[model samples]
Target: MRNKYAIVIICIVALVIIEKENNIILRVSDKLSQFRTLQMPETSSFVIIDDNSSYPDDIYSENVLGAREKGQKHILLMATTRSGSSFVGEFFNQQGADMFYLFEPLWHVEAMLSLGTNGTNSSTSPWVYRDVLKHLFLCDFSLLERFINPPPKDHVTPDLFRRESSVALCENQVCTPVIKGIFEKYHCRTRRCGPLNLTLASEVCQKKRNRVIKTVRVTQLDTLRSLLEDPQLDVRLIQLVRDPRATLASRIVAFPSKYQDWKSWAVNENVSVKEEEVKRLEGNCNNIRMSAELGLSLPKWLEKRYMLVRYEDIARDPMQKAAEMYNFTGIPFTPQTRDWILENTHSHSSGIFSTQKNSSEHVEKWRFKIPFKLAQFVQEICGPTMKLFGYRFVDNEQSLVNKSFSLLEEKKFHFS
Candidate 1:
């Protein structure tokens, strides 16, 4: 009887111990569930990791996070070479001390990688272009230094392509101290500001409220999806397109040696439409049309991020278009920007890459320059692109040269 009583006592004691262990496990599981819930909120603003080594954690913590915290604005002025990009880019470049603008920084990328690649294909990978642009937008100039020939030493490069075009780089902090009288008029390259202190440029970039970069290197729009979707950046893209015939005419004059065959064809009027140069032009048109179509489609990622602006439209009314662009980018169209546009657009400076011009006359001057046959050839090849952008075709030379007969149709492109 005593042995039976002792066995019952042991059984009861075992049951009590198991109950306490079960309660402890349930309490631990509840605490773990709360921890997981806390982690969920961070998913909304996580860093995008492309490559571990290329984009170190420090860069994300410092630059990307900093930009996000400050709510900085980024603007990308995208266009083809000689498509009035330089002219259109000036609107953003001349937006006073608040804006930091980089003029064709990708020229260094292309130049560095041009070796061993066919001219038809991009010498550098599109990802390289995108990466460089991404860093630049975030005010991180370290990545771009890799492409600078002779490489930047201690973050200084004298050979930054077209350094003078960027007023931000030319001004006080980035360039050397200006002499009181003798060197007062000169700035940047002419000023002989010592090798560009890229570190200082980055510091200036961080101080500005806005960053704008103009590039002809980004041939396709979709390649920018990663950049557009980045949680850290509020990027706005403006794609400036000109009539292909006008672009070709401008290229023939601006890059005569490169377009020697086109020049000869313009003079001789005997080149076949199937020539390699003509085929290249056709490819360029198709790329532009494809990108425009994608942007106009209003995909979920591109909502309110993409804008297509015709060079002709801006040339027609510089101030109005400038205001529209500023409004689109959520920037205040300052009086300084307005004044600069009024002065520059009316000026008659016609250098190959000069942004200042009587834009109204410059838009149609191509008709007089390009031969009738060449213009027709461009129309035949770039017809779909031209039509999509509202450029009307000329039936004959009489219609082409008639200044009163406008080639532009009353068409509007809208994006969400």
Candidate 2:
């Protein structure tokens, strides 16, 4: 009996020892895996070659001379996804008859090129894209109307235009009916009009003092150099940038169905969100750096013609920013513009991109919504670009203090 009891005791002790050993092994394995993940390659495939070389002086003179002669005011808002371009576009869209705003007209061309439709393939070439855009900026919408007439439902449907936007264009007589195939008789509307009655649209478009286009598709600044070089067109650029962390966080929350891969970037259900934020941080940093570099390299004529606007700055003080932008473009800052800004930014909304909050609140709301660790990770990734843009970094200490203060405030509110 004693010997049996001894054996039982020994077996129990051995089981406990084995369990402890297994636990140690697991912990070590976990640590090593974490170490490996952190060590994974951080370098990105995208690179920006800083071409700061100036273009010939004669080129600038010819283009400026031509723009003055033609009396054109062409403005392009070059931006990327989640960069508040829609907000800027809508803001400009409210300028009424003074400005004609086109939203992502290149979306169809990009879609067609991606789908290999109409014998177009991935290798269709950059010149094709450039030429299409060049003709597009000139108010020649024949090609633009083809994609809209049939309605490239697969990529960009005409219904993307808000009812008010469509009505505004129609009121201006820029041929919104062209998209619906209702105005075929007015096909000979403008000198640059295409087969689709784009002439009527072009004629109305020409009357507007400012012809504005907002697109997030242009990867290289040089893509629009040809249009800039054209003497007849008075082209200007608004390079819009936003805080990458906020942009990425907004994208992850808002575009779950579209950016499917973002969900996988989180460590937990939320870790993929952090990962996606980091990736976007890296990408936006690259883009912002390239834009700044390109702007510096531009010839004097093009350089003076471009403006860089931070979304946060504009959102914080829309009136001030609007006044400055108008002054820069030589456009009149009317009472209607201020009223529109107040109404649109504060009024009721129908879409995800609606601006329905106090401007400053909207700009700062992202900080509270994102997890501390996630924000820190993104900040680390976008540190350089953030610094360049004068954004305050969210450090660990700041995050902890913020959370503690938030908890205290919540408790105080409950007690009161």
Best candidate (score: TM-score): 1
Clashing pairs in 1: 304-416
Across 1-416, the per-residue lDDT of candidate 2 in tens digits comes to 99999999999999999998676545434433432343211221111111332223342243234555556677788888878888777667777667777777677656545443333333332444454455556555544433343443323233332323322345535433334443232233222221223455566665666777888877667655756665566677778878876777788778877545554544365434445544655876877767656665656556557677788777767878778777656667778778888876765454567655566657666666566666676677777777666566655546633633321111100000
- Clashing pairs in model 2, backbone N/Cα/C closer than 3 A: 265-272, 266-271, 266-272, 267-271, 267-272
Tell me the spans in candidate 2 whose CA falls farther than 4 Å from its real position: 1-67, 117-129, 146-168, 172-197, 260-281, 296-298, 348-351, 397-416
Query: Residue 226 lDDT in model 2?
Result: 59
Q: Find the 10 residues in a row with the least total lDDT in model 2.
A: 407-416
Candidate 1 weakest lDDT stretch, 10 residues: 38-47
Clashes of each: 1, 5
| lDDT score, candidate 1 | 0.79
* Highest-lDDT candidate: 1
How many clashing pairs in candidate 1? 1
Kindly state the number of residue pairs that clash in model 2.
5
Candidate 1: regions farther than 4 A off: 1-59, 66-69, 116-124, 177-192, 269-274
Per-residue lDDT of candidate 1, residues 237-338 (tens digit): 998999999999989898988888877766675653346776789889999999999999989989989999999999999999999899889888989899
